[model samples]
Target: MADVATTVAPLVRRLLGGALPVRLEAWDGSHAGPDVPRGAEALIDDAAAETGHLTIVVRSPDALRRMLFAPGELGMARAYVAGDIDIDGDIFALLDLRHRLGAAGDHVRVGPSLTDIGAVVGILRRLGALGRPLPAPEEEQRRRGRRHSRRRDASAVRHHYDVGNDFYDLVLGPALTYSCAYWGDGVDDLETAQRAKHELVCRKLGLAEGMRVLDVGCGWGSFVIHAARHHGVDAVGITLSPEQADGARARVAEAGLEDRVEIRLQDYRDVTDPPFDAVASVGMFEHVGAAEADTYAAAMAALLVPGGRLLNHAISRPDPHADAGIHARSFIGRYVFPDSALHEVGQVVSALQGAGLEVRDLESLREHYARTLRAWVANLQGDWARAQRLVGPGRARTWRLYMAGSAVAFEAHRISVHQVLAVRPHADGTSAFPATREWLARPLVADGTGGAVGG
Candidate 1:
């Protein structure tokens, strides 16, 4: 057994590259690797060396055991939460590696499938953590003082989205959409589902050639370019992030739609456009605090013509109490996204109506968002180092926690994503639904198969 362990140690070292060192030992002293120093303990086979500066241990095999024979993602997440596995250098980096390796096709298949009741129970139990109250803030005055403002918003946003362009490029496919991909339930791949979501928004807005459209919080301006190039509408995109604004502008030029599409770095409140034919705010509602929901709705209503349509895509909770005990508000407000608050669908509807907009359509995108987050997590895991460099260690860890937590929330039915279509009434107080079918008839799917998910 000792001879066998000695031979396997060199093979393990070769697999991880010389940069990573390994020491292996059997449960009995009969077998041990040369690197295993005397008196050092043996770790389970599932463990992996993680830290760059130290030989940090990963309980991967143990985690896999819990996941395969018990719960899966939820189980692994709980192991981290409980400190069953220790990560030395960067927790986010370790998470990224786990996500990438676990999501690989073979590894994903190895887990007890979601259909397994035990696995589901384990996942639910882990997700139960999200319902627990947040830890009390430290006694330090500096930490308490830091929570009062939006100072961390910029850093938080950058931490999550500013991972290298190449990293995002690998996961998001051609459209580069970072928000929910509207899968039409039966859709097989993410790309088709995402394109369908884009088209669905365009259709709901009743977009026409030469009409003006405004997209608020437009990440990378995918919708702006899509509206102009595909729908023949002139589009303007507004975003608070300089990186997004610059990238969108470059993309617009590359698409030869520079004349038709405009991108700006501006806050939603400052948008003074008189009346656009259509307005869309995608994946940005969460940033508007509860105190700002009314203002946000009013801003959209004000920008649209009397008969104009507005499409708002946002993450929401089923009810106000969904995250009641979770301290989600404080966690996100401080460590993750500052001044961000998720609204319930009812709350959003009331705000829109109060702002004088009538609800035309409402769709729950819970499952779609679940799939989208899963894809994103997998992508981020594949580009761990690049992600770490783009956002510092702490920030990166915060994002991973947020994303993984969000996925669990969605899967457990604690949270949801929604697309609400609204219309500003005409002077006569009537809706203009005429010709709606024509717009809706266009092939939502690129391949002519209408089997896609969302709309």
Candidate 2:
């Protein structure tokens, strides 16, 4: 064991670009640089050199062995949650390394056919008779709880969005739009697609100069600031996180958009002003608990003018049963996001209809989200260390698992994201939009594959 550690430690250090301080000890022997706790049967130094600034202690090799070879992703993440493996440095860096190593076809390699065999085995194991029974109806009900629970709200949004902006900044291209990319004809790269997506929404609602727009669940206030600055719209954005609101305010002020955009840290229910000409809620609906769907729709309806339009971009599950047995709800509810619920496409349509909104357009963005997540995971892998300092080990692990799992889910067609454009019918029952597809198809700038910047 000591020999193996001695050999692997240097290799790992080389991979991490620095010398790592490690202590390896077996049952009857100890090789000391840093003290290995007494009674620690097997100890391997897995700590990287960059992590020296953190105050965390290293765990014994025995504990790490159990965690690394765990049967499921959940078990591996649970080890971090249980403090079985100590990451003395940035947890995000450690997690990024783990994710990159796991995805780099190194950790558990198999040929295509053998990989299929292993997947079959894993599926069977998850469905085995010895597995835990399904949650009882009452327990399932308790899982949803309430949207107003501060603890639940914090857990839900923080689990996904709070994974550090730098990590997202790497993979999300220059726009920093974390939602699905619009891959229409001639759109290839992430930045173009994201910009197209933004412009598409703006055009769909016919955003005009001096128009007042309410952006619900505005992430980073991207749409609000962009619309106000570039399109000459008056925009107000609302978010649940104080960090997001503060950051968005800074961004708005930096762009000299304080006159056109206002961001507030407030719940959607608190938005009581009426008669906004246009509204948008992008990548935010999933956090609205199932019970609050109607309330959410009504809030949007109340905020809109008589014939206002609303563009909603959200991820959707094919069915409620899709998430069963994946521990998705539990992990998302507990570690990552709380009080969040995914709706079926039908459910979204029904809710919009019930709120007296007429659906004008619908687009499936499953492939785009899958690609987006892949990009995000790559970005997260690149900047893991700094991210860990922002959150913690447990949180870092939770995000890695969540993003990877979501990527797999999208790839497998178990989940999807969508963009739905809807409108509150006019008193005369006619849409004010004048053929939106023409503007949507117009080229913003020429494709710049030659390393040239586009407009």
Candidate 3:
């Protein structure tokens, strides 16, 4: 057969129903798509090109089999995660192609059209690349049992967050936050912006001295520590992951705030304490599943006292369709955030309101989340060696691919992260919330040296 790129180009272009936009290079030193520039190597692998220009490097014949067996996105992701494929010239450039693919629908999933299988089989046979299915990388998580049940949810949480505390610390830095950060104009580091984000939530919740607060799905207890130390609130942070709960408790103890902050290895549904003055759910409800969304909102509402505020911070899609949650078969579902689903802001508002909370304010921190993801990508890439050692190369590659792809999606508005502020009003309709949004933008600290947030 002709060289791999020569044989593969036209066929892929036909399956995609368009001309190829990215350069294709193969392990055998064959190339296709865009003309090779004067000085560049015939088979290029560099990752420094302009946006929208990229190279898909087929590193092994098994990459083709992986794609053949899984089809659509999963096949391609497995190839990438298993080191059979690599993207050259900026992962963003490659990810941008995801939306262009007819079946991808603008997310981490890379769904290239898989039609005309006879043609594909014919081509593969001629190229001597056809083979039976290979075992998926060990890192892929095969979800089992009933979805959204406490037992199943616990398993899913462990799949995503039980990798190791050290692994998260390496990626998330000292703030140990796993959500979007409140970025300041002059902020230069991830940890500082993370700290600002936690403090911002504290202010938004109207936290005050001696007030009781609850943090739902509190990853590593950063929010609880920040509120208790800086705002003097008595705080409870709860998470489903044992690893996260352990890490969060250690952090609270290390901060010398054990008396002020408590971290529990508990689910929000299990809490039966008296009403708290405020409640915050940061980046946690995505795992609540669309089917259990109402339950989640009701739980948060039940935890709050009348006139108490609740900050629901989580990722959302712009789609108005109630069923527009992430596909269960997508890359994120299988390998990254197992059983996670993104609800639109409208759905979230409805749930909160249906649970008897008034949505007071809505803010989209879409751009902030994009930047946060990129920072995490940078941290992972910079410490790639250590990361791979911590989580294995397959899992490490999965994180890199997901974060970079998510950055592209956020920049394009395909998905977003929102901070929805709601309050449980008194029977007579007193919200006790500030009439304006000014309170949310206060300086990070009283002295003002730490800089302003949400400004």
lDDT of each: 0.62, 0.61, 0.82
Model 1 scores a C-alpha lDDT of 0.62
lDDT of 3 at 43: 30
Better of 2 and 3 by TM-score: 3
What TM-score fits each model? 0.65, 0.67, 0.92
Tens-digit lDDT string for candidate 3 (262-303): 888887889999599999999988899978989888888888
Task: State model 3's lDDT.
Answer: 0.82
Off by over 4 Å in 1: 1-164, 321-331, 389-396, 434-443, 448-455
Error of 1 at 143 (Å): 9.5
Candidate 2 Cα outliers beyond 4 Å, as residue runs: 1-76, 80-174, 183-189, 320-329, 444-455
State the lDDT at 333 in candidate 3.
77
> What is the C-alpha lDDT profile of model 2 across 359-451, one tens digit per residue?
888888898787777666666656768656666655655565567656666765667888888898877877665555665656544344421
Clash count list over all predictions: 8, 8, 1
Error of 3 at 104 (Å): 4.5
Cα-lDDT of candidate 2: 0.61
